[model samples]
Target: MANTKQAVPDTLPLLRDRIDSIDSQIQALINERAQCAQKVAEVKLAEQGGDAVVFYRPEREAQVLRRVMERNEGPLGNEEMAKIFRQIMSSCLALEKPMRIAFLGPEGTFTQQAALKHFGKSIVSAPMAAIDEVFREVESGAANYGVVPVENSTEGVVNHTLDSFRDSRLKICGEVEVRIHHHLLISPHSNADEVTHIYSHQQSLAQCRAWLDRYWPHAERVAVSSNAEAARLAAEAGKNGRAVAAIAGEVAGEMYGLMTVSANIEDRPDNTTRFLIVGNQEVPASGKDKTSLLISAKNEPGALYHLLEAFERHGVDMTRLETRPSLMSRWGYIFYIDFVGHYQEEGCQAAIAELRDRASEVKVLGSYPVAVL
Candidate 1:
């Protein structure tokens, strides 16, 4: 028994030594991979003429993940393998060219989360005060790409984003959808039962109106500019141990030094928001693509119908359609649409040409790869 116990202790040490050796080997391989990524950056830099060209490709990253999932073995699940490759590609892309992404922020908003999720932590992000400001940043060359909320699955389209597209010439280069989980956050010292008022962005407050009405019947619901800003104010005002909370994310908890009192407070459990990437140049066709356009109808009956009929005739699919009152004329409206297929495809070209002849105005915003979830 004494000999067996001694052997057991020695064997455990040997196993530990083997594990340490394997960990060292893994560290060396990781370093070598990083070096290879830097070399790739050097080659891309030379090809694109110094530092001007944008090298981080969102669509390429999606393709890489899809391929990784397809080739993954059963020992590790597909999602697990894809996540590993996603981070690997993120690191490699950082070395290629650190993307500068702009999102609706004061930070800690769901839009910011979507931007980071889509671009990964490798990107350098800038926060813009307004959704329109995010679009303008990318339009004016201040930001490489801008992420703005386009719509919420439950609450419907964000009118501000649609209105901005009416006049801006920016193109939709990519898209991302993020699941939103709102929390009731308060200062560490504040008691949840003693809360008097709750604050959040106008949209957020509106989204959770039903829930708040049922729960905090007497507490005043206030709207702020953004969720993160609301959280900041809640943390700052909790000095008396009386002021209440803000509806924001757990990530925003540390940002404002607030603690989450209640989690997942949104009306819908599956609430999600879709965001768009706006840029100056139109991306070339990826096999699976979406094209957006702004079309104005002539001052005649059946004008809008005639425009949509072209899609039916060409067999092109219209994914989304929205009408916004045109600023130029009274009672006039512009129709914004998202359609399937690339602009280069024969059917798509035919549809555009037909709409050009049939509509008052038709502007092709651009065709880009379908967004990865």
Candidate 2:
């Protein structure tokens, strides 16, 4: 058996004192870091001479988070350690200048979750009604950056987001992946057994289709604008004596003051969604990076073959290839390609040079640091 001293760590009061000392040290160090960040802002402003000074550096933050994970030893996991540093960096950056972030929402949506994940909660979040509105918000300078869902692991790409990219000139500054956990939620006054109507976003409903099919097969599954909206509707319906439940994330449930009838009701175990960060500033190469391109290949038969060949010949890694119908011509289509390495790198540059020569048009969407967390 373990010794009582080893197991109990002596006394609670002594432990509390040690914790209090550590807390004081942590607070002092954090203030010192914030002061350094303030100096950085002053330096940048002095050099740039006005509002042209840029504050947030996604690559720098990613590097710091990666180092935090690498250097972490023990009681906490790597992600947990990184999360602590992420918030600290967020607070320090806020001391420099608080950023405004836009996302698809009425708040409490997965996109909002992603926005917070990528930029941290120190930002001022602007909830946009639609994907296009998110683009417009950032484009018009209403928000410094925007977050939108690009694809879900189970359901595939968000067509609306991809479609929005065709017209907008926003850059893909970074990426974040959010694990989706859906719950069957109801108001406190709701009778769980009496649920006759179910509400959720179409994607969320489809994600939890199998579970819903097996349990409440007869409940009318109504698709709404967003999961948060569904939660709001369920809250309203319960007060009116209607038996309604919504399939949404925990954030939505808390926001709408609803209780979870069933947690993690999704059919798949790993229902993850990837969101893209859209902004105006171009991110510099961050060692490990990915480049996105919008290519319009000629209608000729061998056009796509030539584009693919360029990447193969240069020994460049291609990660994603998505096709969208071109708005300019009826028969033509736009190809969205994502590949490893920054566009400025020699290999990527050679490959892209070859792509432009073979294709009718080529647009470099953005080359950004790969997601670190």
Candidate 3:
């Protein structure tokens, strides 16, 4: 018996066979699911009478994911299960209709991530270089919808998005809030201790200003088009082994082959950014809805107060009121407002009429379901 080795169980072949069987079953189930999705599309088309509306219902998909997570009882946690369901729903929705979503990008930005989270992995994404370009893409029918950041918990409203709405005819179809986690990334070849310059989008840099001041106080902060773009630039310059890095998402590190030297570098831990979905079509009433409008008030005395009074008398709840200087004319202002109630309701109609009467110009941007997040 002198040191003779025992035979191995050869479980690898058995496991391989089991995997192949499961893959076949999964393939069959996928085909069946796709057929069902086609039926859903047909039903939606019949109900809509060929009206151009996106077939994907994000709220419904979210409900489905919530149910799946609640029922899951496996080695995987609730978040893991929800993630899997999210992708599945994305695929099924794609079968119903593959949506083209335009987002502010060069990928890996929080905006891109939020768009993917809302639209699912099945959507075709176009990364627009500028925010205006994203609005243009949706307006021109080149994309089904556009996703752009409207506000952040830490830094307040994104003024550019508000200004764009002043001229955009696209309606707000939906909204989503994504938790923004900023990270400090450096190329693998770079020495963190020797870093002299940091780069990121201006807003992101601003969001992490306190942290940057506390840590790399002497480093130069260079702003780029986006956080992801800054990551790309840092990775490119790694060949020279310069002391350079960027602040971006952790995923960006993996995408650009960089390393996350620090995580959660934002000044606040509960930083969340709200993004709006813009399209040419209105979203169906989901019971509770919020409508956004752009009102241009005359510079006359009491013009603003009168507009606010109209909503008060109509029993409508106003969520936000922001003022922007009118670009076309001097001594004029544009008021962006968010209010409760659907545009189709009687109270909402009365409020809108009153608002128009008081304001020099009033534009109803869109009414869409309130995002629970």
Ranking by lDDT: 2, 3, 1
lDDT tens per residue, model 1, 198-228:
9898888877888899998899988898999
Please give the CA lDDT of all the candidate structures. Answer: 0.83, 0.91, 0.85
Measured on C-alpha atoms, candidate 2 has an lDDT of 0.91
Q: Among all windows of ten consecutive residues in candidate 2, which has the lowest summed lDDT?
A: 1-10
| RMSD after CA superposition, every candidate | 5.2, 3.4, 7.1
In the range 1-373, model 2's lDDT, one tens digit per residue, is: 1221243345889777766766787798889999999999999899987757889898888889988998888579999888888899988998999999999998999999998888878989899999999999999989989999998988888989888877789999999999999999999878999998999999999999899999999999999999999999999998998879999999999999999899999899999999999999889888889999999989988888899999999999999999988878898888999999999999999999999899988988899889888
Candidate 1: 10-residue stretch with minimal lDDT: 1-10
TM-score of each prediction: 0.88, 0.95, 0.85
Residue 223, model 2: lDDT of 97
Clashing pairs in 3: none
